[model samples]
Target: MTRRDYYEILGISRSATPEEIKKTYRQLALKYHPDRNPGDKEAEAHFKEAAEAYEVLRDPNKKRIYDQYGHEGLHGAGFEGFNNFDDIFSSFSDIFGEMFGFSPGRRSGRRRPSKGADLRYDATITLEDAAAGTELDLDIPRTETCEGCTGTGAEPGSSPERCSACGGKGQVYRSQGFFTISTTCPQCRGTGQYISNPCTTCKGSGKIVREKRLKVKIPPGVDTGATMRLTGEGEAGELGGPPGDLYVLIQVRPHDTFVRQGDNLYVEIPISFVQAALGTTIKVPSLNGEVDLEIKPGTQPNQVYTIKDQGIKHLRGGGKGALTVGIRVQIPTKLTREQEQLLRSFAETVKDTVKGSGKQKRNFFKGF
Candidate 1:
């Protein structure tokens, strides 16, 4: 081990930031590389020094210990520097591989198990079904693990071979100016495995697209924009991971009779002005059925009345909402000769009720 300071080897300030240290190390490594000065032992020594300095400073843990207690602290912590050129190249393959134009080997853990993507299903249900809870069978098209090859993408009793293009790393490297760019291998398409003998059922893919029939239960009082999640019902996973979820979005269709807001139901009932003036009992439409509602005398237009427990049911709690009925009083547009005589006789009994305008009073007695 060299007795010189790590920062001094990389030609950076002692209080330099991590980025500054890395930049200085990159310049030193590029300048004193053995490839540029093949026969110069001094340049080889400088490259080793820069690599060692970078290997220490790039790591926060080792850098902290070194910053606090120096090289002896790193030694006590069991951090021996690179032994040979192979070690330096292998350790910095991610950095140097990108700096130069060589493919970095499979060091990233990209081959681990990955969960499948989630799926969405849009369903429109009648408002009655939404209020009363119903069960439905849905036809869904999705990919599942192939039964022929058991998700291996190969013929039965045969295994997939390692990708030759990417050497099972699933990535290909190409020299682009001063950087090496990595991309998915065209031959293997990032699977890192090649299927020479493919399964006849699903071609070479590890999954198959098929329509699945599933029965789902919808709770009462589910409105539009409500979402339900079904776990493990989505596309099949890759590398033996768990399957994803299926999201069911529900849209409740509009009703012709009732307008729903939250748990309440509203309906307008039109009554004649005669009925509005005199108390009467009438049948009102509700979620359950026709129920009787009483209208008091002199009931004004647009007046609202509530019928208890006649609206939509609660989703979680066990109860029902009230039904709101709005009164709409209709006046007679035309009257017969006998009807006008009867109205004129009635106006004489209640003359004080007809004193709004002079024109209206004149019109009331104009026929008489």
Candidate 2:
């Protein structure tokens, strides 16, 4: 039988771009693939026909020759079409690799498989939440295989077909002067298959974007920039592949009353100068509650007091961290006349006591 026109076989115009040619062939191949349409002789013939058309149109030399002299020119170049399924698959092994993850071969048979993509989310928590573990419900938006189409990208009761252009390999090759170069088949877009009856939901993409709610348990002692991994909780996988993982990155907001370093909590407590001078028991704030902290007599400003077992909880262990309290003595900014008189009197006593001592370095201008 006389061969059909290459452009007509792929359903493309004479001015069709290379990409258009490839895309059209992919659609044809998928519709007539042997695997998809088993026991159908007509489908097999169509598969071979698409592959032949793709082989010629994909190569510049063959395409130019066929365009000038049609199939007669290819006969002169001694180009015989593929003889068997093995020959077709072998010629397009690299193309199949792009369509599937692996190349087609006798030992490595084709299988329906896919692997999900990982996802990340950022969460901000208060210091209290970090000290005590908390549970949260997060709504994660991601792409997953369509439930309606079951990731096939085809309408219900329908199926994807082998790419006719690339013969289900999803790629094409052309011989150069000395080297053979392989490229992605424009027809199938490198999927090695095509969906003629596309699923309306996913628009033939096989995946959908939706939000899913997941419960996340945040561990205690998780600080800023800490990462929590949730296995098998990421975006859903394609086809029958396993689901990916979800990563929750923690961002701890600064606290108004406390600063944390490792397992220690640092807080500054203000005390009146009188209290610092006379010693007193004051209330200190901790993660759990308030506790009594003792201020020694004549305590200086910026002195640190450590309270054991009162800070943040250990992330991985049993013991709690220490609470460090720094004393900030406040001098009276505005004093009453009586208070001023008392302070002046106290200063005089200090001066007199120093004068009474044997130290004789006092200058005469000191009294003035």
RMSD of each: 12.4, 17.0
lDDT of 2 by residue, 51-130 (tens): 88888888889899988988999999988888987566667665543443223343133334556888999999999999
- Residue 97, model 1, lDDT: 58
Best candidate (score: TM-score):
1
Q: Tens digits of per-residue lDDT for model 1 on 1-368?
A: 44789888887887888889877887887788666677899999899988988999999999999999998999999998989876887687666656754334424313556788899999999888999999878898988889999888899989899999888777777777766677668888877888999988889787999999988899998989988899988998986778788999999999999999888999999999989999799999887889999999999999999998888899989998889999999999998989877777788777634543354767769889
* Model 1 TM-score relative to the real fold: 0.67
Tell me each candidate's TM-score.
Answer: 0.67, 0.66
Compute the lDDT of residue 116 as modeled in candidate 1. Answer: 85
Off by over 4 Å in 1: 1-106, 109-111, 173-181, 352-368
What lDDT does candidate 2 reach at residue 97? 37
lDDT at 335, model 2: 83
TM-score of 2: 0.66
